[model samples]
Target: MLKDINLNAMNYFEAVARLGGISKAAEELGVSPSAVSQQIRQFEQQFGVRLFKRDKRKLTLTLDGERLFQTTTQAFRMMRDVRSAIQRQRENRHFNLRVSPSFAVRWLSPRLKEFLDLAPNWAVRIDAAPDFSDFETEVVDLDLRYGEGGWTGLHEEAVVHDLVLPMCSPGYLEELRALSDDPIGQLRQARLIDSVKTHYRWDFWLARHGVMGERMVYPLRFDRSSMALQLAADGAGVVLESSTLALDQLESGALVPLSTAFEAIRFPAYWLVCPSRHTSRRIVRIFSDWMREAGRVHDARAAELITGLGCRIREQSGRQLPGEEYVGE
Candidate 1:
């Protein structure tokens, strides 16, 4: 019967063979030199063969050791390839999604149930942050970005086109109604919550409306768009936000639109960004379909809310604005 060989000892032997010294192998393996030497000794004893000729300053592989190293190298290489293939298969069965924190919290979280319902067996890992760059090196399977579809070297698909409108909580609207007869004038009097870092700003929305007065400038600045939305929800101030993120609040009466004049910016509605090189894995394709459906649902809801509130939305072509009667699912 062939003797059962110790795998750990063989691994140590392989490391030493590749490195040419126990000290080097130890350093690579993050173990002590003594430990590597002991493992080599154990391996030699098991095989009943001296695998190395050790001098005061150097070590060389024996004839038997050379032959063994050749066989073991091929063996480990095959094992490594097999392991990698298995890992890729497992990853194909799952998805790692990355999104901006604001989109994840204000937009995705509210609608994730629908996605889960559609993809019951699929597992998802959401890495939510403001940054959505470097998806390829990070090994992220998918990313959602809030920008124009100009992410160079990435495969991007438009999820939804966005329109920015003034939104405030019901309490703030009540306060405004109490303070001033003109809602727009009252909005100027109230604190204006702003997201200056985003490509789409309140100033752009104001410019579209031809209201480029000093009131277009907001005093309170928020680093994240989500924070500005939350503050607006809390009745702190009016926020110019995407209808996609504010749909739930608007539908639930938590937030009210100040006016019907919403501006559709050239900024990417929303983008599903992925590495240009990565072919669509099964999980990624599934998630992509889910995202497309989610965007449709969001757009439908936003349109519904906007129509119900009698809001006017301009199309990208700069044509005459569509009438409220023309808006539908």
Candidate 2:
């Protein structure tokens, strides 16, 4: 509500004052000198005050014009500062990512370097835990969640489906192979590593194979899925969890996927979660696309390994556990 404050007139006044005359300002503005004079005349008429004191050869600012010029210069200076700040922000590539603890250790930590290489100037700040800080009021830029979608006030994009199955150290696999040439039968006797985080337990997996829950032997339990998978990698026991979570161990031949006699565990997929406003952000979308491609690559690699190890169930009837692109729902 700035009464009688015409921005266009103010702009012309500032230019004429800074350039020292109407003709010079007109040249700078790419307009005729009469146009600049007309705009200034509109200003003086509206204000009922003279803005310039004309002499024989040169024009000088009136007392009123001098006071207005000070304010005009300061206003344009602030505008310049704001524009510079915005441009600097456009150049900055730091991103804040919040992730579940299990995914961070098992998946993102190992592969993050590759994504960083995609954008050399970009740096990421990761906050890992079971839950992330609230995105509504917090500064978290993006998040990953393992859940069924259908939340309000937030944007959700399902990135990848988590496939879980029994896996253990290579030496443990060797022992199981010795116990029986029959894969499913020997897995029943193999020591099981219990993960307290997920619902996929030794008993549930064993019952699918017609073995009673009590028949499966488990000597240790870990509260986090990553910890349980780590124990399995260390050859403590067999772990039933996300292959994507145990990616490093599986890739390094530390842990081997067991026979697919028990169906691979599937639940709601992992989602790329963000505030709705951030959904359109270039960096956020770039990261989302990068991760989706990463998920497909992991699925293809897992499929290749599963086929190589003779663990792929023909009943699954797909080339691989397929990856998915995000849809805003």
Candidate 3:
């Protein structure tokens, strides 16, 4: 039972001691200082040992605390090494991934390098279409999907929930400004590009922006989002692309937002869809963790960009809207 004692308390103590203060430990762990202090107290009580000497203005480890910290630190390091060893073994394991072509091209392909860096030895076979493969019959370890969460008999972890927004290249924006008085309205006068699979169109965006008019302006249509984005970048037209797809371009100033009429469509998030029973494979777990973390980082960056731009736009327009001003979902 003593060997089975709470590791969380041990973690709290180690963090506090390593960081030299409860407040700093809290910041590192994303918790409150009070929480860290309480955990340290509870840990001391559980072990019948004083882990820290609290002076009027500072916290320092006592002799016993130092000893315990040294031992626990080594123990934790060993545990982490063991975990890494296991993950290294798992990385060499074979797995298959199924994903849509557009998702593969726009989102996953760009970030494959990061994933490869994390799991260097892993063998990944990517099938870039959801059709023609049966998860039960096929040997696929995971499926990345875009849809409503209606797929039955599978465990789905949402990688990203996205929203639609109009994105144009900087050159296209410059041209629109130079060509017409009503840049926003004249912006819509140019050719519109469409994604064939996902039917969410410019009308959906325009209606959300309270600018209702004829939307018969699609001169170019593509089955893949990557192509449409390329056309937009070349100043062919404006596209209603997902914030996730436009994220890299938007950051590099290759693309700019047309308006703040983004809508949070509740599509089935980019999910790591896996058959429920066979997910015990070690490789699957590692990839799933990697995908989730990557998704979180991407979403955070997209939100930061959207919020920054949204504030600037609001200040420039001198108008405020109800509800959360458009950010990526």
TM-score to true structure, per model: 0.63, 0.66, 0.61
TM-score of predicted model 3?
0.61
Question: Could you give candidate 1's per-residue lDDT for residues 1-329 as a string of tens digits?
Answer: 33598889898899899888888999989999999999999999988999999898588999999999998988988999999998887656666788877778877887788777776766778888767657646868888876655567889998876666788998888888788877556766777888764555666556656655565568789777777887899988898777777767777888888755443332346778888655457667777888887777767667766777878666553222232111100
lDDT of 2 by residue, 2-24 (tens): 76588888889999999898889
The residue pairs in collision within model 2 are: none
Candidate 2 Cα outliers beyond 4 Å, as residue runs: 1-79, 87-94, 117-123, 260-268, 313-329
C-alpha lDDT values of all predictions: 0.74, 0.75, 0.72
By summed lDDT, the worst window of 10 consecutive residues in model 2 runs over 320-329
> Alpha carbon lDDT of residue 15, candidate 3?
86
Report how far off residue 309 is in candidate 2 (Å). Answer: 1.9
Off by over 4 Å in 3: 1-92, 130-132, 178-184, 207-215, 261-268, 311-329
Clash number for each model:
2, 0, 1
Question: lDDT tens digits, residues 8-27, model 3?
Answer: 98998888888788888899
Cα distance off (Å), candidate 1, residue 77: 18
Q: Give candidate 3's whole-model lDDT.
A: 0.72
Descending-TM-score candidate ranking: 2, 1, 3
Worst 10 residues of 1 by lDDT: 320-329
Candidate 2 Cα deviation (angstroms), residue 321: 21
On TM-score, the leading prediction is: 2
